[model samples]
Target: MRCQNLVCGLVLLLALGTSTVVQATKPEDTAATRAQGQVLFERTCLFCHGATGQGDGPAGWFLGRYASPRPRNFTAGSFKFRSTPSGDLPTDQDLFRTITKGIPGYMPSFASLSEAARWQIVAYVKSFYPGFRTETPVPLPLVGAPTPQLAESLDRGRALYTSFECHTCHGTEGRGDGPVTQAGELKDASGLQIQAADLTRPSSFKNGASLPDLVRTLLTGLDGTPMPSYAARLSDRETDAWDLAQYLRALSAESVP
Candidate 1:
C-alpha cells in the first residue's frame, strides 16, 4: 500500500511541477541588497504597496474597492498567505513564495524577476515592520505526499464535502454563489464584505491552487477572512483533511498553472 501510494503521489507531483519554485538557501541580508530591493519595490511594487508599503497606492484605491482585500496594510503586518500559524509573521520563504506565485486575481506574479531580486524585495517588504528583525518565524511542517488511496480518498472527500457543509459557502458547483453569499452575510476581519472562493477556477486561487497548497490551506485556514480553521474538527484525523483536499481538487475545471 505504501509503495502504491508513493507511486501515485510521485505522478501527481510531477504533473504539478514546481508551482512554488524551491530555493533551499536564503541569501545574505545586506544594505546593498536591500537597496536594490528598494529600487525594485519602487518600480514594480509601489503601485500596490504604496510609497511606504501602506497598501494605499492610487491604483490600489480603485482595485481593492471596498471589499475585504483593499490592498494589504503592510504596516498592520497582516497577510492572507503564509505557512506560519495564524497571527504570526510569515517566514522569509513564505514571502518569497507569495512574490513568486502572487495572489490569483489580486497580486501579479514576479516570477520574471531573478530569484535574488525577489529575495531582495522580500527583504524590503519585511522592512515595513520591526518584527521581521526581532523575530524568526517558522513555517508549519507540511504533510507527506498524496495517500496511496487517492481514488478512495477522493470518494470519501466527495462525501465529506457535503457532510461538512462546505456547499453552504462554496455552493454545490464550487461556484462562489452560495447561500451565505446570497444572504450578504460573509464578512472579513475588517467587517468588509467578502465572498467565498470559486473553487472551479483553481488557476485563480488567491493563496495557492496546487493540491498540497489546498491541504495546507485546509489545515491552517486563511487569517482575517471569512474562512474558518477546520483544524479543530479536521485535525484529529489527517485522512479527513486529505480527502477534503482531493475533493476540492476534483471540483476545479482548470488546473493550477
Candidate 2:
C-alpha cells in the first residue's frame, strides 16, 4: 500500500508540473506578446492577409480561383461562424476557432503553429481595427428618410455599382446573373460553391427584408463569405445603405415592368 501511494503521488506531481509548464507557455495578449506576433505575422501571413490584415495582399488576387468566399477584411468587424451574434465582436475562442479550423474559402488551418502562437496572432489581428477594438462611438449620419430625389440617387448608385464591379455577381439587373454565372461557377472564400443571392428577391433573405437591415448588412457585411463591408473602402455618402436600398428597390420595381 505504501509503494502504491508513492507511485500515485509521483504521477500527480508530474501531471501538476506539466500543467504548470503549459500554463506558463501559453501566450497572453500583452503588448510584448502582440509585438512578437507582429514580427511573426509579417514574416508569414502578411503576403496573404496583408500588412494591415486587410485581406488584400497580392495572394488575394489568386485566391478567388479556389476560395468561394472572399478573404476577410480585417479592417471590418465581420467574422463568420462566430458563436456571438452578428455585429457583436467575436470572442477570443471564436477567433481561435477561425484561426485553427480555418474558414472555408478565406483562410486555411495553420496546424503547424503552437496554441500560444495562434493567440498571439489574434492580438495582432485585432490591432487592425483599433476603433472597433476600442468601441468608439460612430458619428451619426444626416438623419431622415431618403428624399424623393433618392430615385436620382439610385441612378447614380447604379453607375457607382457597375464601376465597383458589383455586376460581376449581382446581375446587371441585380438578379444574381453577372458574368461569373456564364461559367455556372459561384463560390465564396472557403472554396464552397454558392449561389449568389438575388438582391431583387429581397423576400429570399434569411434576414428580414427591411431597408434598415439591408443597409446594416451592406455597411457591416455578412461574416464568413465573399460579401465585404464597404464602410471603409467607399465614402459613406456614396455607399450609403439608404441609397443602395433605394437602388435595390428600383431594380426590383423595374422587374415588374
Candidate 3:
C-alpha cells in the first residue's frame, strides 16, 4: 500500500510541473508575437499612420487637401469603411483589407508585406482598442458593376449601404433612425451630439451636393462628428464612391418628387 501511494504522489507532482511550464511558456510566446508585429508596423506603416496609429504621421499632414477622405484615428475605434455597422468594432479581415489595399487619401497598397505579416499587424493594431473583438463577416453587393450605371446604381448602392452597415446609424431607409440613433445624440470627440443628415431633403444639406463635394466628404470625412473618412476604408476604386453617390442622389430625388 505504501509503494502504491508513493507512485501516485509522483504522478501528481509531474502533472503539476508540466502545467507550470506550459503557463510560463504562453506569455513568452505572446510577447514574441507582439514584438514581431511591432517590427513590421514600424518598418512599413508608421510613415503615414504614425508611430502609434495616431493618423498624424509625417506623410499624414503632407497628403494635402483633396476631394478624397483620409486615414482614421484608430485610437477612437471609429472605422469608416467597415462591413460592420457604425459604432461597432471591425473584424480582423476588415483591418487586413484596409492594410493590404490601402486607402486613397492616407494609405497606399502594401503589396510588399507578406500575408503572414499582415495578419500580425492586424493583431497588433486591435490591441489599441479595449473590448474589440473580430466582427461577423459582412458580405458585399453581389449583382452590380463596381461602378453601376445611374439606373442600377441605387439598387447596387443599397447593397453597399447594407453591406457596410450604413443603416446601423443612418437608418435602413436613410432616415437617420438607425440602431445607434439616440434622438440627436450622436456626438464627435467633443461632447456634442453627432447629427445624421437627412438624405430625403436637399435643402437640409448643411453641406452641398456635387459629385466632387460628396466624394470629398466620403474621403476627408467631416470633422467634429462620427463621420470618419472612407478613402482608405473601402476597397472599390472611385467606383465605390460613385455608386454610393448615385444612391444618395436617388434618396434626395425621392424627397423632392
Candidate 4:
C-alpha cells in the first residue's frame, strides 16, 4: 500500500510538470489572451475600425468625401505599409509598428497604449483575416550598402531612373508632379484617387525615410498604392536599388522652397 501511494504521487508530479512546461512554451492568443485582446479592441478601436473592423465605423463615414484616404478595411487583408513583398501580408511586427506609429496625416498614433495592449490589439486585428492563420510571411531580402562613391552612384541612379521611366510618376525633379500626376491617373487598389508621394519631402514619407527604409520600399513597394516593387526588375549590374535610394536621399536634401 505504501509503494502504490508513492508511485501515484510521482506520476501526478510529472503530469503537473508537463502541463506547466506546455503552458510556458505556448505562444500568446489562447482563449484567455484573445479574450483580453477583444476587450481592448472594443474599448479603443471600435470608433475608427468598426465593431467588425471593416473600416465602416460611424466616425469614419463622418470624415467626409474629402478624406484623401479612407480608413483601412482589415477584413480585406491588404496592407499598404509593409517590409514584405508586394501582395504579401505584413508581419506581426509590421502591424505592431504601424499601430504604434500610425499614419501621420490619416491615422492617429496609438503609442499611449501599453506595449502588451498594443500586441494584443495586433493579435485581435489579425484575427479578422483567415490568411493570418494559414499563411507565413516572407521577408524581403536586404541588399548590400550603397557604393562609397556618392557622385558615381548618383549618376548611375539618374541614368537608371530615366531608363526605368521613374520620371513618369515621380517627376524628373522628384516633386510628385510627374506626367501621371498631371494627368490625374494615380489610384489605389480600392480605386480611390491617390497622389504620388512628393519624394522631395522625406519627412512626409509614410514608410520611414531612413536609407534602409527607402531601400526596403524600393524592394517591397507600398502594396495598395501606385508604387511597384523593383525587386524582380533590377539587374545585378544595372542600377542597384541602393544607388537609387541614395539619389532619392539627395533629392530630399534639395531646398523645397
Best by lDDT: 1
Task: Evaluate all candidate structures by whole-model CA lDDT and list the values in order.
Answer: 0.78, 0.60, 0.58, 0.74
Which pairs clash in model 4? none
Please, what is the TM-score per model?
0.87, 0.45, 0.45, 0.81
Minimal lDDT window, size 10, model 3: 20-29
**Candidate 1 regions with alpha-carbon error over 4 angstroms:** 1-17, 148-151
Ranking by lDDT: 1, 4, 2, 3
lDDT of 4 by residue, 151-199 (tens): 9998887887888788999899998889998898888777776778788
Model 1: lDDT of residue 143:
42
Per-residue error for 193 in candidate 1, Å, reads 1.3
Error of 4 at 1 (Å): 72
lDDT per residue for candidate 1 within 185-236, as digits (tens), equals 9998778888899998887788787777887677667888877666666756
Maximum-TM-score candidate: 1
- Candidate 2 weakest lDDT stretch, 10 residues: 138-147
Estimate, for each residue in 8-32, the C-alpha lDDT of model 2 and write its tens digit. 5565445433422233244767898
Off by over 4 Å in 4: 1-27, 62-68, 146-149, 235-239, 254-257
TM-score, candidate 1, is 0.87
